[model samples]
Target: MAGETAPLGPARVCRLPPPGGAEERVTELCTALLSGFQRYEQRIRARQYMDGLLRTQGRKSIANIATTLGAPGDEHRLRHFVSRSHWAVETVRQALTAFLEESGPASAWVALPVSIPKGGEHTVGVSRHLSPDRSRVVNGQRALGVWYASERVVAPVSWRLELSDDPPTAGRSTGGGPAQEGVPAPQDCLRELLDDVRRWGTPGPPVLMDGRGEDESGRLAALFAGQVPAAARINGWTPLAGGHRTVHGRQAVAALDALSPTLRTHRRGRDGSPDRRPVATATATVRLAGTGNRSRQENRRLTLLGVWHEARREPGELWLTNMDESAADSLLSSARLLHAVGDGWRTRGAAVGLRDYEGRSLHGWHRHMTLASGAYVMSAISSSSDQARSSGRSP
Candidate 1:
């Protein structure tokens, strides 16, 4: 709610002229997103649903959207299209990935975990889970969102719902039921997302993952060993094979504690201020232990990175990377980009109804998310165009 803007409403929808207005842009985006749809009516329905998402005032329920757009007898039709439609969600996502690649190449791929709260018991993948910040337990749907991110923009391109181990409900075939057997670990979900990205034929970019509270650095690094470069936040207690005097394995924090810290300054501020913050950094060559059953000779060599703020007594953050020659500044920049993606999700994502779905089926939730992602991309591109116009340059 902090970064939200007033709704556009029906009045604004009515005032936009044809050929070059925001409505026209929405039409173009929908056409591109759903080009694989076989039926013309499906495309039209998708456009209408997306329009409602962008212009409707309050919650983006099907009934609310239909009523806000002044479309009589459309609530049922839209619900059917979302819940029981035969179209493939993967097709729409592929088109979206293509559109984004053509718009501008992304600098990195990010895996973002989100928690959507629910009041009822029947929604797909609904269960008690930790909040995004891991503050407290809440009843919600846990989802992994894969994003293509750059300094200028960030948008979710694919999503995966984490199924709960709760017993299957009677007659439910779509989601949170017998269709999926058990819940996958967060690292498994991230691996599946990366596989999807690779299958889309997009350029492999360095992956940035949030491993703040978990000690999955070895497993996460193994995911990108021979595929693409990666940097993941590592727990201080993660075991390492090198960077210590003893032959025994040592913790990441202990390895850094044995080394000298290098002083560095960060120029980019979170609030866009020019002030610089001096940071102490250190690095050591190490190998992550317990990745797999590989022998010591087969284990991949990794760089253990440690950073300490002037105010903190110990290292504030630890990271593990497969990029052996990566500089400390570059890895820190990637960390900043990770924060930017999170901010974009909290603000732009909320505005486009990222968590407003009211469906009970797995396919329905995915369809709604696909449309919401399109709306987010369109809004981001439109805002960028407006800024370019105001600055007397090309969009």
Candidate 2:
């Protein structure tokens, strides 16, 4: 449905807490989410850890959490809970999905690969990579997350770690071996994750990726062929022509940079400021490279949505989608939903110390990230619930 949103059902209401009873509500939430733990002690430990993690003043290190909660054995027990506990992460995964379903239906799925810079080499899967934030090379571990997003919330539905072929220093091992044994490439991890998402049903929204994954359109298109529609940002100068004339061949940057501003739009300013800018958009049918069929080099026509900002002279942003112009425009034009994915990352980092994981084991990395995702989902739900109640609407 282009330019249209399905009407939401009666909003689900979160049971309110009594006056001065906010902690009880949070505790209740924690218990429900931690019920996935197989052992009763595991459940208790998980709850205690979450409570302190949220209340802890600084980085969510094991020592800080242990000291803040005054738990026995300081960081030892807490460390065991995350790095050595036998609780199955899959159980928590299912619980999180169930809670998200109860919150509301999702409008889209965003796949973001997060890069966490690490100072030590002992961290599992830590490898040298070009850090997008740092603008230079850095040692880091990369994790890919597929998040479900609606107008009110965005939460991860699936996650995978990118493994490098290089062997880890002593005491460090790859989190999990790839299917084939040797270290798996990042693309391999993405393919497997996308396949897993395909099996996850309900609120099945289209998937969106950033410029990095968009460059691998061939494999991505083949993987999702005729099942789920996909959209991605492409660099300018991607061999698009305005007309069928053979001489019209030109890069996306050349084609879009020449157009004048045709639309004006406003975006919320950072730091509570207001900002406005002149913007323009144009739609065209372009043959994106790598979208050709394998049987032969047959090009598949895709709707190309181009957005240009007067300030950024280069290609502002180019979106390639299988939907018609109206549908593609409706889905990606505002671009706010895209930015919300980054917001999810920021919230996790500030509130939960998303980058402070201390374990070096493969399972430990997965376990920590899984719990972090749960914490983030709950926070989003609570925030939206408060907003709904304040507005005199159920949520």
Backbone clashes per model, in order?
Answer: 0, 6
Residue pairs that clash (backbone atoms under 3 angstroms), model 1 = none
Highest lDDT: which candidate? 1
lDDT of 1 by residue, 238-310 (tens): 6556633322122444445443243232434323344655555567766765556446422666676666554
Model 2 lDDT per residue over 1-395, tens place: 11111111122323222222434445555666788876788887777676666778877777788888887575787787787767766667656766655546556667676778773445777877765434467778777777766665667766776766764531343332223356655556666666655655353677776543322445345434554666765544344333442111124334532332322233332222345444555666655444456333224556666555444443356666767665744554324555667666766545865676765776776677777777665565456567666888655
For all predicted structures, in order, the TM-scores are: 0.80, 0.75
Top candidate on TM-score is 1
Worst 10 residues of 2 by lDDT: 1-10
Off by over 4 Å in 2: 1-32, 72-74, 119-121, 167-181, 201-203, 213-226, 237-250, 253-278, 287-293, 296-299, 311-314, 382-395
Q: After superposition, how far is residue 266 of candidate 2 from its true place, in Å?
A: 16
**Distance (Å) between predicted and true CA of 37, model 2?**
1.8
